[model samples]
Target: MSAMAAPREHDGADEHLMELPSMRNPDPPPPPLPAAPPRRGLNFHPAVYVGFWITLSSATILFNKWILSTCEFAFPIFLTTWHLVFATAATQLLARTTDLLDGRHRVKMTGRIYLRAIMPIGLFFSLSLICSNKAYIYLSVAFIQMLKATTPVAVLVASWALSLSTPSLRTLGNVALIVVGVIIASWGEIALDATGVIYQVLGICFEATRLVMVQRLLSANEYKMDPLVSLYYFAPVCALINGAFFLVLEAGQISWVNDVMGKVGLPMLTLNACVAFALNVSVVFLIGRTSSLVLTLCGVLKDILLVVLSILIWQTEVTLLQFIGYSIALAGLVWYKLGPEKVLEHLVLLKQAAMEGRALGVVAVGVVTVLLVGVVWYAFSGPEGGGV
Candidate 1:
């Protein structure tokens, strides 16, 4: 009995010793994770990106207008096809030669996805380009820009239709102001072409639909792509569709080639294509660097500048009523984008500034009031008040 008790005590001691080892020597904590490497490449200023995008975008539009209208190469379908073709080739080349389109590798793109997703979007994109180019042939650049001010309204409506966004009455009301302004501008057009207005309106609708579809695609993480990668997928399909249309509609007009080459020159056409492609690339940089608000403001500024340039370059006739309407449209656009809360916040700040007796704030309020009064007076005055 004494020997048995001694062995049991020894066994207990051995169990205690086993517990000690684990307590004293738990597995070592995981090695510190390797520090992430610093990002490489030149960091450009946001202004640089914004300016580059604006320059390319404005240049592309002006160049296309010059080609289709001034040069009298009136085959919009053919010109649009050429642009898509060049874009397709350029994007493919960039993908092979550089890492700019590396983001595409992450996209879980399959044949089914391309057919169902990309193809439909491409169809609308092609239509929008074709219609917009055709409008330039009939409408002045200033009027087209005025009409385009309603694009956000169209996009918002499309978003609601697609169920991407809930229909808010407040938002709807804000956008309605844009429509009203555009209607007034259209009424004031000195050389309003019904055909051109139809084409531009159709273009806006198609573009809005495309934008909504793109928003849906981008909602999925697997479908996320930068603008360049998006172009790489979209350009090819759009090019093919536009090519089909060109063959059906414009191919019979064989005389266009001689006119285009002789008047515009092959070199100028090539440069136009290059500028259009560059605009896509610039969009990538601009989006990466800037916020949506910046893009919206920049676009508004570009349109205004384009209107002024049209007046100077093509002697485009813009009546006083058109200017008033366009200004209203721009104001509505800003208000919509900024939201009522933001606008109120700014107003509050302005009030504070006025209370503080800031000269700039006082001047701004006075100027705005004077302008509003003047616009009201002129609008009611007579036909002469609204004349060019």
Candidate 2:
């Protein structure tokens, strides 16, 4: 009996050891099979966004010029009012129909905010548009573009005066370079109009002030808005303000039945309005997809292209002195925005690349040198009336 009991006890101990092994290592459930990353939908490249913005902006400018100058509508205030009214209606339609203007919902806008913040900005916006459009009647597109290079300088001064930015000597110097360039360009302008220049200058001041005010509005966390939403809020007020100005200034002069409906047909005017509104939509995409640096650079490119287009389309005369001055202003504008550190870094990279015999750096330097030489030679030897 004792031997039988001993054998059974040995068997029981073996069974317990097998059970323990099974309980301790249960295979970890096959390690959870690793989740797949979510698939992303089609994303546009930054260049696409940049190109869209440039095309729309150029179209808007050219279209407005055509309507105001070539088409002989000549009434800037009326045209401006029409644009704002169309913008107001379009934004309202978009808000009702699409998710595009949903950003406006995020803004904590109250009546007080609208009265205090938006109305003032809209007033300046109206003034800016009126004056800018008026200037187009007198100024050529190339000269207008060159003059606009000073906008950043005006904005900087406005910011300082409004106490939004502290005064900086370095910044002042950078912007001063832009002023010098614009002055030189102005000097070289063959069809310079003092009246047009005054209008443009006033427009720049109003625009600068509006931008500063916009900065202040956006500083608050509650008031965050993209370009479209800002337009949605501001457009109505601007339209009303522009309408008032139109009634006061252009009501008697512009017989809408004759001037608008007869000369510029409804289809043409509607198309023009659509292009203008599309430009604002493009701004939404541009600002959303790109950095501020990209926007600044693209703006510079757009302005340059506009100058070229003006020459091709309208035979606008751009002199060598004007080119030199505009180039200087653009350089100053870039320097001001990018700062010394970034500029130095780029210069260092170029130096290193040239030293290493890279094709890109060497080619860039060569191209720039060729351009400078060509410009100098043309200025010295070209005919008095001949221009780029």
Candidate 3:
């Protein structure tokens, strides 16, 4: 009996040992929640995703400006069409050859879901890009940036109308400040182009609709927040739609040999497309992991940085009124993000600390925020060699 019991015990021990590795994941732990201190550098955090989106988006604008204005490409529709083509190729290649997009559903291009959900989004997307690129022909970068500030307002209102978001009055009021700043900036615009304004507003409406559609199509719990996957699905549809537009509007009139793209600019345009594709990936990531409100805030912050960059790189003229209006807008954006309750909560905490002695959390959070912002600014502000 003792020998039999010993054998059974040993068998149980062997079974337990065999299951040990299977019991736990071997992969690294995921990045923590936003409430936790943010870890930087290509991690799966919302901050990192938003940072990627901002960097690529900023690069896209600067690159497109160079291609259009400096290089005199004279082919906005072709350029956008090429971006979609490149994105589709790159995403498809990655999906086929790598495990990066492995678990993504591997969704096919020809499904009822595709026609009903994605096709409409792609049509609007095509229109938005076309209008956006066309606007650049009429508007200065500074003016465009000013108009772009109204994106948050457009997004929120569209979201509310579509039942995509339920923002509080405080949020609406905060976004209103953005609108006010934008109006002030527009009022200050030196060369007001009515056509450009029309194009921009139309593009904004289409874009706002697209964003809401994205949430409706993809805001599911089971979906993995992989930007690559989203790109794989959306890229082909957008490419086909843009391709049709390009063929109709641009194919006959384009001067292939005289155009910048034909004369040693292919590589440059390809590189620009690569960056644009990366921006799409970052967009999907940010949208998947964060809210539209957060995405709106991210856009506002990026516009601020772009305004500064427009001053530095493009040598765009800036007025005192424009500068002051933008500053007020930035302040409003910050206040809106923090909200009255959060601001009051922080103030109460600080007050209590003044009266008593508990203040570590507030102090720590402030220090961390300051340090992170400093690091990011130093990194992206580029080399500081010359000054005014």
Using all chains and alpha carbons, the TM-scores for the candidates as numbered come to 0.80, 0.82, 0.71
Residue 223 in model 3: lDDT: 30
- Badly placed stretches (over 4 Å) of model 3 are 1-53, 106-110, 163-171, 219-225, 260-264, 281-301, 336-338, 343-388
lDDT of 1 by residue, 1-388 (tens): 0001111111000110000000100011111112112224735787786677667766777788888889888888888888888888988999999877887898899999999999998898888888888999999887888998787787777877777667777778887778888888888899899999999999888877876677667656677565567778988898899999989998888464586678777788789888877766665544435544455556666676677667657867677778778888988876776676876787798899999999988986786567555444443453344355
Q: In candidate 3, where is summed lDDT lowest over 10 consecutive residues?
A: 16-25
Over 109-169, each residue of candidate 3 has an lDDT whose tens digit, in order, gives: 3478778977887787777777777777777666687775565466567667776556567
CA lDDT of every candidate: 0.69, 0.70, 0.58
Q: Per-candidate RMSD vs. true structure? A: 19.5, 21.6, 14.3
The candidate with the higher TM-score, 1 or 2, is: 2
For model 2 the TM-score comes to 0.82
**CA displacement after TM-score superposition, residue 135 of candidate 2 (Å):** 0.3
Return the top candidate by lDDT.
2
Give the CA lDDT, 0 to 100, for residue 79 in model 2: 83
Alpha-carbon runs more than 4 Å astray in model 2: 1-42, 350-388
**lDDT (10s digit) by residue, model 2, range 1-388:** 0001111111000110000000100000010112112224525786786788677778878888888889888898888888888888999999999877887887899999999999998898888889989998999888888887787777778878887677787778777898999999999999989999999899878877876677667656567565567778988999999899998999989886889998798899889888878866755554445444555556666777777677767767778889889999888866766676876777798899999999988976786677556545544454444464
lDDT of 1: 0.69
